[model samples]
Target chain A: MSARTLLRVLPPVVLLALLAYLPYLSFSVPGVLPGRVNGPGSMQLLATCLVFAGFALSYDVVFGRTGLLSFGHALFIAAGSYLLTVSLADWSMPLPLAVLVALGGTTLLALVVGAVALRVGGIAFAMVTLAFAQAASIIVLRDPAGVTGGEEGKALARDAVPELLVGVANAPYRYWLALGFLVVALVLVRLLVRSRAGHAMAAVRENESRAAVLGLSVYRVKLLALVVGSFLGGLGGVVHALVLGGSGPHLTTAEFTLSLLVMVVLGGAGSTWGAVVGGFLYHYADARLTEASGSGVLDALPGVLQSVLAQPLFVLGAFFVVVVYFAPSGLTGLGGRLVRKGVRT
Target chain B: MSDLVLVLVTGLGLGALYFLAASGLSLVYGLMGVLNFAHGSFMTAGAYAAWLTMDALPGSMAVGLRLLVAAVVAVLVGAAVGVLAEAVLIRPLYRHHIQQVLVTVGLSLASVAAVQGIWGSDPHPVAKPALLAGTVEVLGARLPVDRFLYLAVALALYGGLLALLERTRLGLVIRAGVENRTMVQALGIDVRRTFTVVFGLGGAVAALAGVLYSQYAGTVSPLQGGSLLIYAFIVVVIGGMGSLTGTAVAAMAVGLVQQLANYYAASGIGDLSVVLLLALVLLLRPSSLKGAAA
Candidate 1:
């Protein structure tokens, strides 16, 4: 490849390499980075972070790039997880087939949901999506089918997953599987954003009426984005289920949706790479704060401070409020400004 | 016939709670074009305030008097939180729905965390006042006295709010502002002040709902507000975004559907039915609902 091409390829190549070997690095560096790298305890958190990175990137495709603010994004992720879990646990399907079924089912779901949601634009669309998601969550919790395991959630038996992807005993392998999915997600989203359809999505987002006036099928563009974005979201769910060995009703909560929103917003909405960065930062911070709160390190502090630290959601909320108010464009926007200033200097 | 009466009355009772929860949300949406997701948090806050007040009061006081005092405290606390939230959290992001959603969601999460911090994750039981704890016979059926009280209070609130919006100078200004904020601002009125009041009132209303509903259900959990927020959103959507009357009607309808679905179908079908109804309505008649704000 030419130097220009090499330069273009270098970042993703480096990222892939780092992610692919993260478990090994962590395992080898027990002294430098104790719990997080030395064992399954922290590697499990990293695995989840990888899954969420894919999910957040998919969300960025709609919210960041297409300017479609969807409140029901969790439904896609949960659908993928739940479908895969049920197929494996109930029907005794192979892992590969279960994964295939999940992706296809979620894509169709996105298409149907998108068709209904896209009929209305803006805030109405958001509300419609939220209502659908709420309904789905209620169904999951109700679990009339006796399959979802209701509030306790459904977990995979060791035999249900591929031996390589089973958690704990083969934690590093699970991490690699999650990392591979993230790579697939990144490549897919990058390609989508650079394609002709991607340009169409941008045009529609910029101004729906104008795009419609100019002969762009606004509905089709939106539906296409939703379909592709949700497929990626489902893939994230598959990774979530595979790495964690289970799925739960918690996957469908509005709080979960907000967390995804925070991840995208904290990273910068329209930037694909920003979503990945934001996802890693968010999950890492969340895990660290949760660990700190439970670690009893704050016991020496004042009672009120101890109470505040003990509840990690409060910290996450405070972080979100600060980010939206002071850094609306998120870290990516901040990075962009600094680069621009450097060029000017 | 008694079963029908029971269903209708029970659903209306639930509708009354829905009205109390959603009216403030609808008003804020009308006035500011922002959906306050943290509205439920305010409700939870109100419930906690009432709980605390009742806990602190002298045990020998009359139940009715104690109830009134607790409600006042709850409303006051809710209003204070509202003012503080509006000033600090919501003031900067006016007219941006997406930003408003993001911030309020954050606020909601923060509020949930705060609630969990203060109250812990356990559910607290709100004992109904002695007078409202009795059962009453209506049309050959037994019903709790508190349900009747909730309906009466909800109706009175609905009527009072209507009069305030239709008959009072402030209400007229609020209505006019919702219709055209820039034009109202150009007329030399401090629209910002009106919004602050609206935000605070919205908080008070949601708090009242929280207090009363917790008393009605006999339990208040830290995370209850998050789930209730969903039902409120459904009411707002079904009734038309900004229409108080529409909201009332929609709430009743949802209440009826929920009660009936619970009776006739599987345990969780009620929520599913409401959402499906919303989808069908949106699909079939997106523009027919008259109270769309934007």
Candidate 2:
């Protein structure tokens, strides 16, 4: 890529960089809340958004790049989280070590899943991936007594060290950590997308028959993407568990799974910034809509509406429709269109 | 012997219900080649429609009346969906498989949300006909009257669908359309209209499943569509994609597998185990299924 092309992408990249360091700004400035962020709940929301942004990106790898729509990628995330919890909480391994284990574990699992699920393309790919995910989730749900903690998830005891991390356990500190992870994830993904493997994936997705005629191993590219996608999913899951402090069968639920995918669609698949922005917007509604109050009696409205909108599945579903219908290219596409209009004007 | 009979009967009953839904999904995918993700959402809608009707109608005739109401509503709703979907999404991406798949997925999400916006997400209880609620002892096996009724409905619907496909002019067009859409169009019948009819039939069949699902599950929640929609995809894949016979056999297999697995793995990993089985079956028999189709 030329400097001129990079120049066009710089604005959004720089803007995200600033957002990443927001926690540092808050911490250096004034009184800040511990664990909760901003001395208020704002920081908590930011961290939440960043973590899931990581998740949506993973889905983007498969759905956006590979053009494979998987209804069950949550399997890898839940797998990573449990592995992390067992490592750090029950066994008391170092946090960094646990995260590494999670990465490797999920990567291996993805490899196995991808090997078989990628055997065919089209609807078969979607169905088989979903079957794998649902199967894993059911197994976890059934084991209520053991690893999953059943319907009730198990909690990780915050270790002393990452003692520095523990000391700065405020929202801002957590924000920077998550941001660091996000940058690493993005850079790695960017590098991968530029690799020969990524080109192969694009080729396979374009026209499998032609790609096969050209002697490209279609299944190999898919397997690579699936494994990489799963690795990212597992990493995101670790961050999510670290943020939430516990794990449960909620991992098996469709609500969050669909929401994560919806975020990918909303942000525009195949774009890094799209996933980030989509994640922020999703968390905004998640945190704010449930807590929104207008009038004096609005305070009571949250209590009542909270139960009704307790699940954002409907909203996410609506977003999926709207995004796919109007903005097929997603927010990224919309951005491209806006830029074109501005240039013309 | 009696216990075995009970399990088999109940499994058949459940399997029949699934067939009602999967048949529609398979038909839509076969003709259009777009995997309709929203099939489940319609099922959820049909369940609610049937529930509301049964609840409103007077006793002694509520069951029959609700069935009539649900079947009509299901067909109409399915037709409306077919028309709207064909006009907006389907018509544009006639040959583009990826676009068609993504559009239907979007439609599925939209429909599910629309249903939620209208009805909310709470589970709604659907009452079976009071006349058929009692249990009957047949051949030493105790079975609910509704189960027998479901089996009967399933047989009738399948027979009717088979006959219509084999004997009717519309069926001939659809079959011709599936075999070669361009050729069918060249033959002078509007292939698009043929698609519309197929969509309507698919939707109506889905509705029938929803009616039965509500009564069998005892509660039809807002999640019914998304929930059942996933199963439709699974059933279709296992059923050999575009084959009607494949769809029926696959649904029965899935239903019976659900029962037998529930019996054995009931304590832990039962449900997951079944899904795992689905995954394994595909991985091993990839050729026998999609392989044949390709």
Candidate 3:
């Protein structure tokens, strides 16, 4: 193809190739990774990050693309995880069938919630979705019929999972599975954004009245984005369950959904790579900050200061505020600006 | 019959608490199109401030006198924090509604985490005065005396707020600002100053709610404000965002529904029933909530 197209294509291919080859690497980044790059601990952390990156992208479909500020996205993700686990352990369903059931269930949930929430536009829609998510969170915490395990969380049934994906020794396989998930999520989001409905969503986000005047069905477009985004979020939840070996009530919280919003905003909303990078960086920093909290550097500080630094959310939240003030478009947008300045120079 | 009275009185007490928490939030949202997610953090800070004040007081001092001082300190701290948040974090991002909400979200997360870090996540048992801890007989039902205090305080706040809105010039500006901020601004009124005042007012009231809530629960924790915040949010939405009267009415309904449901049906069913109430409200009258959009 042309030089411009080649340049655009080259970076992602190289990045993907590097990620695919990460399992064979033996190098360790002492403070960053828990072990060698290929080791189970690092692999598990990386895999989790990838799953979140995909999760954040799913959220972007609504918040970033369609400008729909939903506070209940966590419900779908939790649904994917809890459903798959419950199906495997309780219903004795096969692994493949369980995954399908989880995805299907999440889609149905999105449809119902989206339809109800979209009844009132603007901030009202956000409140409605939040109420639904809160309801789900309460149900999960209650753990009725002894299914959810309440605060303790539900562990994956080893008998249901394949031998190749079951143990710590097989971390590389799970890592690969997570990478595949991210790829599929990326491709699907790319396709959707380029579709006719995607255009409608964009139009609706810009001006609802104008878009409606232009003969675009605003409600349908919004519902489409919610369903697709939630469906992908469910897929992330399934992968998250596999990577973590369980489903916790943490996934069903309003805070979890807020963090997704933070990630998308931090990475640069409405951009494919921005959401992914935001999610990956956010999860990585959260993990590493906890590790760093115990490191000697922070220990040397006074008691109160040390305690403040120890909390990952405190640091991330402060950083997010700074980002919102100084870098409104997020890291990618900032990077784009610097790149443009460099080219001009 | 006694149980019903207990439940009803307790529910009203709880509703009073919700009203206190939601009033500031509703006013802020009504006037300034910002959802103020950090409103809970304001409450938490106020609670902690009061707790710290009480803990620092001399043991020989009368507990009742110390609590009064603590309440005063909490209200001041809350108002100061509210004003600072408005001036520093919110004022700069004028007209950027989404960013304002996002900043508040970040502030809430950070503030709560900071509190957890400094104090640890464990709940601190609050020192209640003898009068507050004791039970009083009402219609053959012995109820905690704190419920009555909550009701009294809430009624007073409600009355004060109504008078302020109905009589004061600042109240007139706030009311007009909520209806058409641009036109008010066009009239050469510095609506921004009013935003700060409303935030300060919200903070002070929310702080009072925090202190009262800690007394009700007999403990103060970092997450206390957040948990109460969800119900407050539900109250705000159900009451119709920005309408003080609506918030007061909705708060009572939610509080009564929750207490009655928990007592009559199941423990967690009350929380679920409140959510159902929100859904039912949305389905029945979507236009009521449409006023929230600036």
Model 3 Cα lDDT, one tens digit per residue, A1-71 = 99999999999999999999999999998988998999999999999999999999999999999999998
Ranking of predictions according to TM-score: 3, 1, 2
Best by DockQ: 3
Give the least accurate 10-residue stretch of model 1 chain B, judged by summed lDDT: B285-294
lDDT of 2 by residue, A1-345 (tens): 999999988985897778765655444332222332354355666777777788888888888888777767888888888888877866678877988898899999999888878776777887777777766666666665476676677686666235434432465666666676677778878888899888877887777788889998877878888889889889888877776665666676554566677788788877777876776677666565444322133445455443434334445555666677678778877998999999999
Number of the candidate with higher DockQ, 1 or 2: 1
Report per-candidate DockQ: 0.70, 0.36, 0.81
Model 3, residue pairs in steric clash? none
Q: DockQ rank, highest first? A: 3, 1, 2
| Model 3 segments more than 4 A misplaced | B292-294
Q: Which candidate is the best by lDDT?
A: 3
Docking class of 2: acceptable
Worst 10 residues of 1 chain A by lDDT: A25-34
lDDT of each: 0.85, 0.72, 0.93
lDDT of 2: 0.72
What is the clash tally of candidate 2?
6
Native-referenced DockQ of model 2? 0.36
